[model samples]
Target: MMVGRDVQFAVDKKPCEVGKPILEVEDLVVPSKVHKNNAVRGVSFNVRAGEIVCVAGIDGNGQSELIYGITGLEKPTSGTIRLEGRDITNAPIRERSKAGMSHIPEDRHKHGLVLDYTLADNMVLQRYWQPEFQNHGFIKKNAVLQYAERLIKQYDVRSGQGPATIARSMSGGNQQKAIIAREVDKDPQLLVAVQPTRGLDVGAIEYIHKQIVAERDKGRAVLLVSLELDEVMNLSDRILVIYEGEIVGEFDPKKTTVEELGLYMAGAKKQGEAKA
Candidate 1:
């Protein structure tokens, strides 16, 4: 005897069509706020459209700093970052956003959302300056609410009070969903996702995974930083193993094993040349 319901498993995903590079980072060095040595040291890579390029490493191995450097959360000490061939190494966060970059930050509270704001407001936090959401410095409340409701429904971001609910009051998973909804709806060409499914339940994880894959299939360039080995293997088109702020190895997910990746991630192995 087996249990059956009206359900379809969510693991299957359409393959993405990878194209030219959308984001380029060369010789990036980000200093650690807490340590004397740099956090990200001479790191470099590129994320092309229609592919998920994952930076796999243990926590505290400069993954956060790499993302920070690329997304303008922290200025790089040296090297250049380019989006669609234009240099944006010193661009502000808002400038990066305007240049087709969307970030799903690791710390949702610290960087992803303003807890005190209503759900509707948070939905357009990055785009409120646009003419559609604002006019002559006044927020178009009705338009904002309508857009938020649309995202909430599409992304399944559940809240007790709908669009009026405070962001901090929502469940952790729902809050993550809301952030993703906001970022994805921006129609970015380069999506920098750091731990996009970090603390969600299985169902939420499945949903988020599908959403990321869907973005890739839409020809978006996805730079994924993750600690989960299974996710790294399952979702990545290519994997770059990081150790002590440097990329130690690059592997095709279909050809590499977890143990092999673990060795590189732990500083036990280093390829002679890890291609970008």
Candidate 2:
């Protein structure tokens, strides 16, 4: 059994109604770049405010493609992605960010951080162009530094030279922390955290888990795409098992066993198939 440490950060947990979905993906399809078949086929789901919905399956089951489609990193072949009832299927990356979406991408090196940039600069990669951090097409260096300092402290992000350290020089866990700090601090309506705790130490994993839970408690919808069953079982309120480019079954984490979930993830059982 895995044990989680006490959460150090203070977050207000309030009751939030699970009515009215905040994000909806209907009949989504994503074609593979290197293959003839679609990467994701007719996938559909809705994430409500104040809930942590996890997409759980083995690696290479199209989970990454699904996230890419939703985050606008890759255009979908067909179907609609609605955020707060607004169709943003074909919106650009910045537009999705402006539409209240924050993503902790699966590949931190490629999608999360600018390795050559200083820690402070990477901290504001998504928001540096905003009015708060820029004026007259010039970045407000001091403001950016201050903001980075605050996040580093709040999220326990460590680096060799504080905010001046090069991002590539930081450890993986610290890099992940910086990404989380930037994304979560934005207070986005929907947070797409794909493998947020992929390769972190136990302490870091515990802290990230708390942060995710804290987000859900604050009435923000979190779409967690993780292959770790422990994280799926511990952090999510609902589980979606995706297999062969499709969702095979949905379950309440509290009501489903890992063994049963494993069966669905392996394509041994499906939503309508009879249980033996």
Clashing pairs in 1: none
| lDDT by residue for model 1 (1-276), tens | 122333334456666678999999899999999899999999988999999999999999999988998999998899999999999999999999999999999999999999999999999999999999999999999999999999999999999999999999998899999999999999999988999888887777878888899999999999999999989998999999999999989999888899999999888889995555
- How well is each residue in 24-65 modelled by candidate 2, as lDDT tens digits? 999999999878999999999999999989999999899999
What TM-score goes with each of the models?
0.95, 0.93
User: Global lDDT of each model?
Assistant: 0.92, 0.91
> Native-vs-model 2 lDDT?
0.91
Compared to the true structure, candidate 1 yields what TM-score? 0.95
Q: Output the lDDT of residue 73, model 1.
A: 90
Error of 1 at 20 (Å): 0.7
